[model samples]
Structures are given as C-alpha cells and as structure tokens.
Target: MADNLNADLSCPICIDFFTEPVSLECGHSFCRDCILNASRAQGEPTGSIACPQCRQNTARLAIRSNRLLANIVEGFQRLWQPQPAGSGATPAQCQLHQQELRLFCSEDLQLICRLCWSSDAHSQHSCTAIKSAYTACKANSIQLLQKKLNEYRDTHTATGLKISETLEHTNRLQEQMAAEFAELQHFLQQRERALVQRLRAVAESAVNQLVENMALISERCVLIEQALEEIQSTQEQTQFLREIKGILQRCDLQTKPALKTPELHLGEFNGPLQYTVWKQMLNIISPAPVPLTLDSESASLDLVLSKDQTMVKGRSKLKEFSHHAKRFSNYGCVLAREGFTTGKHYWEVNVESIDEWIIGAVKESIDRHSAFALTPSNGLWTLRKWNGNIYGPHHATESECCQNMNLQKVGVCVDYEGGQVSFYNADDMTHLYTSTDRFTEKIYPFFLPFPETMTKGVLKLFHLQL
Candidate 1:
C-alpha cells in the first residue's frame, strides 16, 4: 500500500513529491515551477504549447496554481507516513486523486487507479485487474526460472563430461609410461642374466682345457721319475743306456707344448648402459613374431624363387613357371606368404650379397601389375639401395648415401598398435631409419632385388641365429 501511495505523489516530470502543485487545461498536474519551465521551453520553439503527458496542443500556456489541490496535498502530507508489513486494515489510496489502486498497467507493469487510466497518459495503455495480471505474470516467471535452471543443469553435465575425459586421458598416459618403464626393467634383468651366463661359459671352457693339460703333464712326470728309479737300480751299462733312451723318447721335455691362456672375448659392459638398454628394447618390443617366407605366387617373372621360399634371385631371363594372377607382371617385387593383422613383428634380411635391393613391408592389396611409384601412400614402406646409396619412399635424392660399402644385413621390425616400422643394421644392431603409419589392413613383408646393369643381385631371407 505504501508502494502505491508513494508512486501517486511522485511527479511525472521530476519523479519526486510535487512542489507547489499547478494544473493545466489538459487536467494533468505538475509542480508550479516544473510546468512553467516545460511550457516556456516548449512554446518558445513552436508557437503552440503542448501538454507534457499527451502532447496535446493548446493556444495558451496558462497554468494556474492549484490552491485547492495544494491545500489537499498539504493536508494529506501529514498522513503520508510509512506503513509496516501486513498492516492490512485499510487499503492504500492514490495520493494524487485519492482513488483506490484497483487496476494494473500492463505497459508500465505497475498498479494504478481508475482516474489514472482515464487520463490520456494511460488511456491507450493496456490495463487489467491487478489479480489477473499477477496470476499470468507469476506463471510466466515460473517457466522462465525453470528454463534458467535447465541451462545450469546442461552446463554442469558438460563440465562433468569434460572432467571424465580428462581423467581417462591422464590414466592412459600414465599406463603407457608405466608399461615402458616395466619393459625397460625386464630387459635389463634379462640382459644381466645373459651376460652372467656367457661369463660362466667362458670361464668353464678355459678351466677344463687347463685341467686336461695338467693331467697330461702329471702322467709325463711320473714316467720320468719311474725311469730315474729304474736307471738308479740298473747294474748293467746297456740296461741303463736303453732305459735312459726310452725315458727321453717317452718324455720329450724340450718339445712340451707352451701354456697359453684363452682370451675371454666377452663384449664390453662399460660403455653407455642406457644406450645398450635402449638398443635391446628394439629386439624385445615387437608387436608379433613374424617368421616370413617369400610367396612364390607374388614373385616377379625375372625372380628365381628358391625351393624353401626363403630366397629370391633376380635373373636377366624370365624363369619358366606357371603364370598366376597374383604375380607381379611389371616390377621386380614380391610379397610374403603370411600377413599380419595386429601386434608387433620382427624379421631380418641378409642384403650383404645383393648389389641393390628394396626391403620393407607393404599392404597386402598393393597394386603390383601396373607401373607404380614405390611410396608409403602407394602401400609400400621400403628403403632402397641404388648406386651405392640408401633412399626411402618418395625421396628425390639419397637421404643417406651408403658410405660403408661393406654394409650387408638389415633387420626390420613392425609395431601395429604403435604404428611404427624401423630398419636396422643387423650386424651391430644400429638404427638406420624408422617410418610411422597407421595400418588399415593386413600388412605383408615386401622385397625386391634392384639388380645393377652388370650384376644380378639376390634377396634372401635371413634365418634366426638360434
């Protein structure tokens, strides 16, 4: 109610309690000074004065001091005291018109009286019963609040999902790191055990040889001592001479074999331990075991496939064999008999005898009948030796020219899950190159003997040492 009372007394111009009230022809009231200032300023520009509330024009700007209304305002001022909560005995009335505030102005969204609605200021504005307006607005407010609540809920759900993904990623990284550490630990233990075994074998072999030599010498010494005893007991000169001659012939002291100690050719353990462990990782971390053989069905016509299918030689004249659809008709390439689906695999190739060769893995369905570019994108992951230089796929020039002409064997390893394929020097376990690619289908070992103009090279599968 106090809210209603204060709003009525508020000036439309100053928006405060009206001072020395005045009324114009339009019946809208304002403070005396407020009306005069507005009228003078408005009429000075346009010869007609307009009512501030409705903008209605009039011939005159005569605003008379509302003495009767002023006196009423003064009398009512004493009654304009603040109301306390729930003092619902008497309803608050409009201080301007002394009317009950029963109507709600939809445009202003506030309570008003019948007199306020009658004025041009609110005549065109939508008005309704205060109770009806409150009911409709409350329903809309509830929906709006619920919509805001749903938005917050969606935000929380998104935040939670992000948190879960982050945690999962963190755990995966931790697992991979842990597995690598465990692999290193296991490899170190295995290496230590192998070295210890080798040391024992070397020591045992040397000791056995020395012990055998000692036994032979002991027997020879006993024979010499026996000869001396017999000679000392001999009374005849011929017997003594014959015994001495026999002893000297049996025991040739001057011609005794020289004692030689076997040198233990154990490899140096004092170099970089970390480097050694890292190199061994390549041998142990294979995705799968690949014992491969050349597929005779996929061999080129110029290739002579060995009976064991473990070797192929490039020849000038095409070999006499039954033609097959799977065989390469245009290029010197061959695929392995077996293909890998997943995991890691390792295989070695003896390329020392071959003058030129291309060795790596390839997708099983690679194009083999047409003239093709040997690149990774073309399903080939190979390293080539041409003109005594080593090159990879799609390379224009040799990345590493084969400086060591004595280079021979190379080991290839693959990891499907890790999407890695690496080549190494087989003799010294030295890294040559590594290619990284995701596998979409089964991959097979690829080999080619790039024979020189004068020499027909051979590509042979290297057998396991043990």
Candidate 2:
C-alpha cells in the first residue's frame, strides 16, 4: 500500500510527490519548477518557446498552473494517508462485504474489495493496488487530453473556413441563376410580341386582297346596270344588241382572282429546357471587368508608363519621372495604380516582348531594397520566370527549366478577402500557379517583367473579364 501510494504521488522529475504541477503545451506535465528549468535550457530561434517533452513551439511566455490536477493529487494523498490505529472510526470498507476495498481494476476503473476480487466478475481481471492504478491513469490521461485539445482547435478552425466558403459559393450561384432566368424571360417576351404581330399581318393581307376583288366586281355590276337601263330606255334592238355583244366578248373565260393569304412564318420556341438556356447563357452573358488604371507613382524607374497608364514598356526612353517613396528601387517591380482591398477581380497581362518576369499580387508594404527572396513569407505571392525556367511560389522543385517553355501572355486572378491569387496562360488559360496569402493590407497587381534591355520585354496591363 505504501509503495503504491509513493508511486502515484511521485513527480517524474523529482521522483517524489508533486510540488505544484504545471502543464506544458505538449500534453506533458511536470513539477512547475522542473518544466521551467527545461524550457530555459534551450531557446527557440523563431522566438516561440518549445515544450521540453514533445518539442511543440508556442509564443506563450509562461504556462499556467494545473489547478484541477493539483486538487486531485491532494485528494489522492489524503486517501492514501494512514490514520492512527483506533483513533479514526475506520478506513473505507465495501458496503456489501463490510471489508476494506483495496484492489483496483484498470479496465473497470473501479476499486474492488478483497472478497469481490475473487468473484466471477473480477477473477479474470487484472487488478493492482488502488494507488498504482490511479497514478498510471493520471500520467497517461493528462498527455492524451492535451493532444485532443490541440486537435480540436485545428479542426474547428478548418471547419469554420470551409463553412464560410461554401455559403459564399451558394450565394453566388443563386445570383447567377437569377440573372440568367431574368434574361431568358425578357427574350421570350420579345419573341412572342414579334410572332403575334406577324400573325395579325397575315390576317390583314388576306382581308385586303378580298376587298380589292370585291371592289372590281362592284364596278362591273355598275356597268352592267347602266347597260340594262340603256337597253330599256333606248327601245332600240340594234343598240342593245351592240352593247350585249361587247359585254359577252369581254366576259368570256374570265374568273375572279383567288384571295391570297400572307405566308407568315412564326418563330418556334426551341428548348432543351432551362439547362440548355443556362449552358448557353454562360457563353452569351459576359460580365464586364471592373475598370482600373495604373498608378505611375508606384512604377519602377526602369519602366515607362503609357499616357493612359494602362500600358507600360521596358524600352521607352521617356524623361525620368519624379521620385517617390512608394516607387520600387531595387527589384524591377511595379505595382498597379489601383489597389484592391476586397472582392474577386480578374485581369490579364500581355507579356509580348518579355522573356523573364515575376508577376502576382504584392503586399502594399513590400520591402523595396531587401535582397531577401521574393517569397510569400516576405509578403510576395508571385509566379516568376528567370532565364528559361518557370517557377511557382510553393516549392523549390516546382519549376520547369525546359528550353521550349512557351509563356506568351499571362492571366492574373485575385480573390482578396479569400486570400488567394491564381495565374494562368492567357492564351489557353492553362493554370500556371496559385498562391495562398497572409494578407493584412491592401494588395495590388504587382509586375516585375524584365527591363526593355532584356529581350525587348514589355509588360502591358489589360482587363480581361469573366
């Protein structure tokens, strides 16, 4: 009993009972003084402190005391303490047997009186002194708990991001459907009106043709009536006979003209159904790009800004523009005149004369003179090409150094709030690279095409919308 109690209450470092236990981020617990000494033994290069047990890094300066653990240790100590013989009433005794409950079953996690240990339920179970089981359980449980907590935190964050993106996608889909449906309805109405007008014209043409025939018949009837009056009033057989002969000759083999109906062809309602419209709508409905122009102030000295600032070239020998702090000094990088703080924007770049370039979204405050690698860690999310190699921002080996690396034009797509930028070949829209961001400020479309002296390179900004 005494040995089990000693082991349960012992601190791993001191090999004695715990004296103010503290928890480390790695799920390992130790005496408060012991863990602190271990942390100070080694320093983190990145300024984040690392746990001595698992080596997990964190920025916390000091760890909090495990108060609940301390209380449990105290309770176990009291439970194991020996009472003066006959001075206290008694130690814990099992209710059924009135015998002391001594053995602990690790699997059942319960104390068993001596009589119960020999019973059918406990005979095959592994049992040890209660104190030994308690100590072992606490040792493994604390570490397990810390691991679970860390896992939960990461899972929660990832789940939250997924939910947000999914909801946004749903909303965007709804808006697209609404717009397409409205357009389809408007189109159907115009076609229906046109068909109805054509049907009325057919009826009108048929009625007009019949009316003209009737007018001609009425004129002949008037002539016949005049001839009959002349026959009755003249009272001369020879005059009547002459008129009748002329009428008979004119009427021979002649018939009324047939009424001609207008051959009106009404437009048909072609349908594969809504799906067909939706599919066709994608090709017909082109959304306009958000209008933006370049900011010459942010242009690098080696670059020349066009009069409208929408185009820039490396070859122009324009007079040097006034200097500004925002201008890039070291790298041949230039920022767009306008910066995007939020929303989705897409634009295309004409890389006609450029053989080497680095283009993507640049942080608003990128270091101009730092020789540091232009990586995402340094606030640059770029897809770069040097000599003949095309490189992505993610991995060192994620590059193609082939001789026939065809890169004529490039497309830049930015999702500001989503913290992503994707680049593609403008001609075929073959995906080139995509980067995740850690953006905290407004970002602009950054350009770093080779200067005009380098292969007559020219980087022109043009808006290509979806």
Candidate 3:
C-alpha cells in the first residue's frame, strides 16, 4: 500500500514520478543537479546544470530543499544512530556534488554541507541570511498597482467636470435665444398696431372727400336744369310776339266804316326777346370774368364755383390744371389771355411741363406776351404769357381742389397770336399718378376739337363734364 501510494507521488517540477527528471530550457528541473554540477566543472556556468539521463539543463545555483524529504531522512538517520558491534552504516551523499550534506539551514530552507559552501561553486555567493527579499518584492508590486488606480480616478474626475460645464453653457444659450424670440414677437405686434391705426386715418379722410365731391356735383346738375327751363320759356314768348306782328301787318286801316269807326295801330316790337333771354342765360352760367386789372395786381387768380352757377374769384390761382397740355398742337394756345375781347380762353399743358413753365400767377406781362411769338428754344414755356388761361379739372371748384388731388388733370397754358388749340382732360395722362411710371421723353402735341360756333378770333370755353 505504501509503495502504491509512493508510485502516485510526483516531483514538483515535472508533476510526475521522480525517475530521471531533467532540467529545462530555463535551467529549472527535478533530480538533475548531479549532471548539472559535472557540466559546471567542465566550465559551464554555475546556474547551468544538466541531467545526464534526460539531457536536460538546470540552474545549479538555485537551492532545491524538499522539507518532507528532509524530515524523513532525519528520522531514518536518528533510528540508525546506534548500530551492532560488527555492523557498518553507509553515509548519504549528494549525487550532484558527490559530497555529504551535514547542515539544514532554516533561514534559506536549504540543506547544505560545509564543504559545498567552501567550494568554488558557492564560495563567493553569500550564505542564506534571511527571507526578506520576497516580502520586499510583494510590497513594491502593491505600490505600483496603487499608482495606476490613482491615475484612473483623476482622469474620470476631469471628464465629469467637463461634461457638467458643457451642459450649463448649453442651457444658458437656450434661455437667451428664447428671450430674443419673445422680444421679436412683441416688436412685430407693436408695429402692426401702429400701421393699422395710420391706415384707418387715411381711409377716413378719403371717404370724407368723396362725400363732399358728390354733393358739389349734385348741386351743379340742379343749376343746369334751371338754366334749361329759362331758355325754353324765352323761346315760347318770342314765337307769340312774331305771330301777333304778322297779323297787324296783314290788316288794312285805309278802308273806314261810316258809323262808329275804331282807330287801330300795330306797334312793332323792336327788341330781340329770344336772343336777349338766351344771352342772359349764358351770362348766368358763364364763369365770372376775372378783371384784367385785378388779375395783374393779384399774385395769382383764384376761380371758385357756386351752386347757383356763379364763379367766385378767390385769392389763389387755379390750384390744378388739365393733364393733356402736351397734346396741344398750337403751343402758343396754352398761354392765351383770359377775359380778352375774344371770349373765355383756356389751354392745356403736360404735367411735366408745369415746373418749366411760368409758376405762380403772372405779376406783369412780358413784352413778348403773344403765345405764338414764344419759341421752344427761348424757354418761354417756363414763363407766363397773356393769350390763354390754364386750368386743371380739380380747380373747377374749391372743394374738389385738394393738395393730394390726382395729377391727371393738371396742365399749363400758352396763348400766342391767332390760332389756338386747347387740350382738355384725357385718359392718356394716367402715368402721372404713380411714381413707378417714368416719363422718359418729351410729350407730343394734342389738339382740341373746336366748336363751329367759335369764331377764329373768339376764345372758346372748355369744361370738364365728367
């Protein structure tokens, strides 16, 4: 049973039964010291030992001390200390060094003899003094592990701080952005309210103006109807008088009756009743004559209209004029003098030409007052002349003439010597109302259709009907 148990026992290095154990490439093995010692004696390094049986090397310098084996050997040596008188006891020897091992050192836990220590192989090597090297190596390894742990902890702390700071900054920026958005919304709302209020005010003013214009136009229509009625009545009276006159002419007063004769004489009605009535009607509707003397003294001529068809002259010149001035074929016509013996004279000019023409009312007539005598090269279009009156549609009445009135009916007039052409309001002048429309070129001439009743020397009157 003991032999069976021993069979299972193993050498620590080979982890197998100790039989011819050999050293390894690292010079560490079991039962290879004797071969290693012999190799060393042949000039091999002390640590380099080999096994003859297995041809393996070992570190001879490493002390191999087996505690259990030493205990068993000691027990056996004690039992055999006293022997029989004639019996001989064999001494144990180290197979590696071929020497006896006498001492067992507890400090190194190695078995050694005095001869081995004194031998050249181990003579210079220090004897086993203490076992503190193992404890020191273990302590140094623990310190290195602690340093690595500290480095990892510091790195983790720094990374965490950066993450916190980034989050805080992001939150602050988001709050600022939100505040800006709120302010922008408030500003837009305020502007919107202001704009709405301004638009309302403008709309109200426009509506009031429109209402006033309607009232004025309605009054004008009533006066025109009354004038027509008066004309019809005058025509009827003149026809009656003509019939009575014919009857008187046919009756013979020479043949006399003998008893109770009555003397009858037909008196001729000399006055042209119809013509007189028509003339009176015309005067009522006609624009009031602006006196030449007054016109000359005043800075400008002001023309105002009443519901009774009376023209009132105010202190200001016609605030507006017709827009078709550029279309007049006779440029001189625009400067014609009003209230001339010829009749009521008027002309038109383009809106663009007004600034170049005589601005304000004529204070004094220039020597070359005739519109025809004025030439385009002389810049006479920019000066006032005596031939005609310039009028705008808006200036037909006071209420209609607004500073913001559409420029469509504004024009200047020039009247020269004989022939005259007057341009009235027309649709082609629509461009003046908007800034986007550009006037790139000079305006051409436009002629007014003359009425047959208007004699060559007589001035013609033109009015805006619509």
Candidate 4:
C-alpha cells in the first residue's frame, strides 16, 4: 500500500515525490521545474504549452498548485521514518481477547494472552512465560551461529592450505618446463652444427674438383702456346710438324671430360624448415599416443570386434563366444586390452557419422555384468553422444561441457597422477570437456556403440603416425 501511495504521489516527469507540485488542465501532475522544462522543450511561448502526458495544449499560467498531494507525500515520508533510540517497541497483543500476550503456547507455537491460556482452546497445551521463551530462543540462535562460524573458519583454513599447495605445484611445473626446453635447445644446436658441417664438406669437395680442372687447363694452354711458337719460329718443316702432333695430342687429353661439379642438395633444409624440424622432434618427445586395441574378451555379446581389435560395431545378431567374466553382459561396452595404473596416455577414436557412442575411461574393477551409470562415482569418466546431443559426466549437456565446436574424431587423454581425463575434437585438437578424479586403480579405455539395433556406424581406433 505504501509503495502504491508513493507511486501515486510521484511526478510523472521526475519519477520522484512531487517538488512544488502543480497540475495541468489535462489532469496530469508534475513538479514545477519539470513542467517549466517541458514548456521550453516544446519551443513555444510561455503563455501556452503542451501537456507532456496528454499532448494537449494548455496555458502555462493555468497550472494550479496541488496542495493536498504535497501534504500527503510529506505525511507518508514521516510515517515510515525510524523512531528515535530508547523508544520502547510495541508488545504483541491477543486480537480476540484484547489483552497483552504474555504467555506462550507450545502446541500452537504462538503467543497468547493470560485469559486465552486458561481457555479450553489452549487448556491442554503446555504454556510458558514469554520472557523464558525469548531467552531460550536467543540461546539457540547463538549456538547455531557459533556452529556455522566454526565451520566457515575451518573451510577458510583449508582453502589457504590448498592455495599454498597449488603454488608449490606450479613452481615445480615451471622448473620442469625450463629443463625440458633446455634439452630441446641443446638438441637443436647439435643438429644445426651437424647440418652446417655436412654442407661445408660438400662445398669444399666441389671447389677442389674445379681447382684441379683449372690447373689442367692452364698446363694445356702453356703447351699450346709453345706449339704455336714452334710452328711460327721453326725453319725446319719436319721439326715443326713433329711438335704440332705432340701439341694436338696434349690438347685432346685436356679436352677429355673433367669431373662433373659435385651436386649439393639441401634435402629438407631448404624450405618449410620449422615444420620439418617439428616432425623430427616428435621422435624425441615423450608420452606419445598409446596404441589402444579393444579387448575381444571384454566386449558385449551384442557387439562385434574387427580382426585387429581396433574397430568395434554393433552386431545384427548375437555371436556365440566363450563366456568371460570380464565381458560387459548388459551394456554394449568394450574395454581396451591395455590398462594404465600410472603416467599419462592419449588416444583417439574415429566417431565420424556415429550418432550414439560413449568413449572414455573406466575403472578396471568395475562390475561388468550390470548396467552402470556413466559417472565418476560409478567408476566411469566419459563423454557420451546420445540422441544427437553430447553429454559429459553426470549427464551434463554439451553446453555444460563447454563444447563450442564440431566433433569428428574424438581424442581422449588421461593423466593418472594428475587425476584428469580430457576429451577433444581430434580433427582440430579443440578441447571438449575434462573430468578430474583421484583414481585408485588401473583404468582402461572403453567404448560403447550404443542402441544395440539403431546405430550402424563403427568406432575405429585412430593410430597416431608420430
């Protein structure tokens, strides 16, 4: 009621309690300054102006002061103002009995007057002095607040410890990164020296061959010059003829093919230099992709495995196989043959055109015969695509998993010690989701072709060339 009354008293233009309130002939009210501004905004004469609310022309001087509304607004303001300190608060009273409520009714959880406490309405109910009830209520509130305060303080201390632990871990990672980069730099330096030396050795051999050819030509030229001089200066025709024959033979020997210039090839050092080096660097890098193959013994009867065990597809008809306790009897799920208890491992699965599939890691010891929920608490950390929608752990949707890109092939990476399992779009290496958990035992890669009869696409393990 107060809010409505306040809204009624407020000026339409100023949106506040009217200051020097005035009313136009159109029945709309506004502050004196607000109406004056509106009149000027209309760019009309002061004697005549349009009413801002109704857009009807009216004489500015005809506006009347609203004394009643001004008084009501002032009274409403004072009514809600807080009373001065030491002013006693009003005590509760029984509406029916019209008496001070000094008794408490335990059964009704209400305050009652003395007369009502004795009446049949509350005769069987336990009653206590309101003063005693107030004391007990205050004590309980204090106790509850203390308990919450202790809990919050303990949480604060634990958070501080976590912060310290994270900082220490970050420092260790920095040291490791620096050491690894130093090793790469050393390798690059040695490779550079070896390549440069090889090039220099080829250049020297080519230059030496060219120098030998030049020396032989110089000797032949000297012989030819001597032969020319003997032919021109000789008085005996027989001697000149003999020397000419020897000179011609010398020229023929010099004309014989000299060693071809040694071909110098840069091989991979010419262009796309960085890419070539990076490809070679893969040979030295650790934690390469794991070679994961589906375990045929662990596959469900409704699923079929390829000869290489790298692909799995739903079976049109159930296949007869030796009963294995490790096989998933309920769900069309298959565990990888290799399991990891420690260290980081990465692998990719071709999920292209596959509508429904579940790919991730599962605990080695999880129940194989029963259908289990895809969640960390159930010993499964997985990303699933079902009914055209992708889901992460706990059935969270694709948006919740922060999947902002298309997925073709799916990449799964697990860091056992770091307690993290991450999924990605293998085509572009875009991260899709990550789940963290403290793993206690061996975990194996798992795949599900899903919907026994509906899905037709096969899930193939992608082999990494690096």
Tens digits of per-residue lDDT for model 4, 1-466: 8767767876665455677798888888887876786577557786887887788877877889999888887887678645567988766779997966866776787888755755668857776666556787568678989999999999999999999999999999999889889888987887788878978888888888888878877777787787677667887888877777776675575565454566667664577777777777777666666778889989988888899999888888776789999988888889999999998899999987577788999998899987777789999999887666678878765336543334679999999998999998888888888999999999999898784644668889988774
In the order shown, the candidates' Cα RMSDs to the true structure are 15.3, 16.4, 38.8, 20.4
- Clash-forming residue pairs, model 1: 287-343, 287-344, 288-344, 288-345
Q: With candidate 3 superimposed using the best TM-score fit, by how many Å does residue 106's alpha carbon deviate from the native?
A: 26
Tens-place lDDT per residue, model 1, 1-466, is 8557555665566444567887767888787665556667454444455778987665454666777767766666567644566876665687777966766777887777756755667767777655556888778779989999999999999999999999997999799879988987888888888877877888888888888788877887887887678777888987777677776776676677555576566455446766776666757664433568889899887777789998888676755888788898888778889888787788888887776778889987888789888888888888777767777665556566355455688888877776778887888878887888989999898888864332645677877542
Clashes of 2: 2
Q: Which model is ahead, 1 or 2, in terms of lDDT?
A: 1
lDDT of candidate 2 vs native?
A: 0.70
TM for every model, in the order presented, reads: 0.43, 0.46, 0.23, 0.68
Best by TM-score: 4
Ranking by lDDT: 4, 1, 2, 3
Show the lowest summed lDDT stretch of 10 residues, model 2.
Answer: 263-272
Top lDDT hit? 4
* Model 3 misplaced stretches (Cα beyond 4 Å): 1-164, 184-192, 228-235, 238-466
lDDT agreement of model 3 with the native: 0.38
lDDT of each: 0.74, 0.70, 0.38, 0.80
